[model samples]
Target: MSVHDLWDGLPKAEIARRRQKNAVRWQRRWRGPDINPTTGRLAQHKQSYSDNQKPQALLDEAAQIQSPHQQGTRSSSVTVGTLLDRHLAAKADRAPKTIEADEYHASVVRDTFGDRVLSTIDATEIEIWSQRAEPAASSRKKQLELLRAAIKRGVRDNLVGVDVTEGLVVSLRHTERPYWSSQELRAVVDAASSDFDATMFRVLGFLGLRENEMRTLRVGDLVGNQLTVRDSKTRAGIRTLPVPASVLPSLVELAGSRPKADWLFVSPRRPGNAVSKGYANAALTRAVGGANAIRIDPIRRLSAHGLRHTFAAIALSEAGGNLLSVSRALGHARPSITLDRYGHLAPAGLEPLMALVDAFAVPKAA
Candidate 1:
């Protein structure tokens, strides 16, 4: 038989099946209550792609455009905006600063694809969006993480089909954390415009409290030589630290007879409020300016947080490389976190390394 006549041996149904298998390719069937393209009503959706189209990609696109919601379900479709709103509402109990951060990060997502159907968001779309995001790499990474967390919660709540942010990664450029040297710190303290400014410097450099923590300090928090951290960024940060003798007298004198609830570092501009971050920065700048004017060894301008780091560095060096002590004093959640940032600065000795080997050493055969 001729090539054309060979098909005549088979039934018409088989011939049609072979033609379908060879001539026309169908994308994987996506069964969902999508809007029918032919009839703008909720029905089973079907679509075909050209030879140049990827079956998987076409299927994904169809799914996103068609059935973002469940079939026959009376629930409203969820969007990125809805997810972020829900996420924010759920975090009503978090600290105000934490909530503010969440909102800031959430705004980036909201501004980009907030109205987009949450179910339609895929990893590829997010990755592309992240690349175009205007925030610095670190800030953008935080924003991405916030969006991922919201989507993850949506999935757990059955509001989303999948977590599209599963494997997304944002690379951050590492920069050295600036800190003040001991001599620089002492010069800044000596050059302080007022006794209170000098005391603030001492508190930050000796206590290792964060700038905010220092600003929020209260007289009642200090008891003899013990200082209590009542409020902090994390629960681990709420710790009591032994007051260094060097700063004790200054703190006691600063406390005077102020009420327990009164702020230790009251705002210079706003009397009722705690010291502003701007004031902290300006104080450091002024002190550095004074130190540079007369000193042979000029001081580098540093932020208030740099004093906290200086405290960590000093503690690690003076405490015989006691990582635990430094970590606890700095209110780090874990010793590993402390080690990651300052481990190299720890005093190195063969004795500590040899001790580890000695612990596992076997007695020589007698």
Candidate 2:
């Protein structure tokens, strides 16, 4: 029989059984809500190479946190927009920039989930959205913070009975990267294309400056030998980062021709302004492609923030994980952020690594 007749040879019962199995297979693979094709805005996690195929019959259930145990059925009264508007009004007392960021999220949330009842969002959607963009660990972390904030507000306002993000994993534990050995630094910094960009990298990689701190670094910020960061991301972000002794000679060389507000690394297009960190990051990614010029830990991918992370890691490894010194270097509000991100910099050797099994298995040495 031809292909058409061969398909018809399957009995009606067999075809139904095959269709049912296919539906289950596809449904199991869906990671999130179906996305809108026109917007490229994801309502769900789509497979990377979807062929416009969907199993229409079996849309797996919406994710939910609480297994309803006679607690009231989901009250579908509140739209996602309603919750967001309420959040804006309640956050009126926060910092303007913070309020502005929330407002931006509010706009996107409204467009994305505006019509859906607050009840419809569940645990699975939460997981997929946070990690969807394959955002940098830092971005994933902040997005989770935002999600937790919104959910907490929802619970506070009686929109939900529980914060569903309690089980969320915001960032995976990552290995601490070794600071560049002198040889590696020379390979990258002294290479033909990297001379100037290397200067910018040192300010961040050595000094633990935030992206903005580096972008806004001014001719006036450098005095004699140190880069004074009096105002950084927070009130605590204000602290001077010592210039590496190795780099002072070059910085002094570059100092001869400069303007008062001229950024240390000027944006190519904007001329007088600082290089946008995002743009700088992209350019550097392209520049470093397969170029083994810098030797980071093989497992640790290098990025602009990796520079800051490496600085803290080096400080801790060189100084026995001194939280106090690293905190001051990073201008963190508390030593905790410093310790959490880079404390593992100095391998606690094998003691802590083996503690998991040792704790449970070690009988008293009677």
Candidate 3:
């Protein structure tokens, strides 16, 4: 019998109502056909769980009881598909965007190893699968990460004996972000024809805000010498940054008695709207072209993001190789991310550690 058979041909609304009502009740009861097909009689099936069991877990258990075949018998062994279901169930309360991303990642995993037993997956097989799975490194890495998470859930539930991915390592093979030097940035700023272009470039180079974040800035976001990011793509992206003294006048002038809720950078095409990405890009393109015309060393063509990178590169040098300051400024969720991207720019030498070792040594002669 299928799980829907327990509903006894009830309409969708009634089934939903009963499911909602049964969600809180301790004993889950459902009616289905008798074990023998020839009996032609209805049999009631009931199951109970402890109060400590979560509602979702209880629902999954009820599903197993109603239709073992449909739910895939858990009595034998756990499969990758089962672990994925558990993983997704645990994240039901997350944001919709996050859930969507998880679903996409799960689909990528299911296509390759959904039916495989969790216990049988080992590091060697995982490594081989990763190599042949997907050609795109980033997508391949995300798929492996999702599979690893599912295996972790299986291990936690005691369905799997050991974690095979514990010792596995995968490299992302990232490329360095493009950025401009101080002179190139100065040239671009000098070449800007209007105050609007100059201020936009200053914000990108000096403050290191993302294009979206900068465009969405409001008059109220700037208070005194600090700016608060109210809207961002990630939680870490919402933060307050100290505006540079050099750019304060231009920023204040740009804001210029506008209402608190008004977009800091108004769109010319669409009234009462924030600056669009195309407009921002076109502005940067004009500045780069003008800078190239005047300078002996032509500035490389790069996106607005390169200006943010320029800020990080310069700030790291100015802050005495402090990754935390630069990471926080860049709105990175973790300092390790900043170190991973810009650690090569830090001064490399073991002289201080060597001096410490010498200090700990005993007298050479007595």
Comparison by lDDT, 1 against 3, better one? 1
Off by over 4 Å in 3: 1-76, 93-95, 156-159, 268-271, 317-321, 333-343, 346-366
RMSD of 1: 18.1
Off by over 4 Å in 1: 1-77, 186-198, 210-216, 229-240, 256-296, 312-366
**Residue 25, candidate 1: alpha-carbon lDDT:** 39
Report the number of the highest-TM-score candidate: 3
Best-to-worst ranking by lDDT:
1, 3, 2
Clashing pairs in 2: 33-44
Please give, for residues 1-366, the per-residue lDDT of candidate 3 as tens digits. 112234557798987897877643344455574563566667778654323233334465456646747444453466677777777767666656667877897887877777787666668888887777456766676677777887787667655666777766556666788888777887888888788889999998988998888899999989999989766655677799999898899999989898999999888778899989877678889989998887787888878888888888878755454778788888886676677678766655788558879987958776
lDDT of 2 by residue, 195-244 (tens): 56777666666677777777776777778887778656555677876687
- Residue 352 miss distance in model 2 (angstroms): 16
Query: C-alpha displacement of 175 in model 1, angstroms?
Result: 3.6
Model 2 TM-score relative to the real fold = 0.46
| Alpha-carbon lDDT, every model | 0.75, 0.60, 0.75
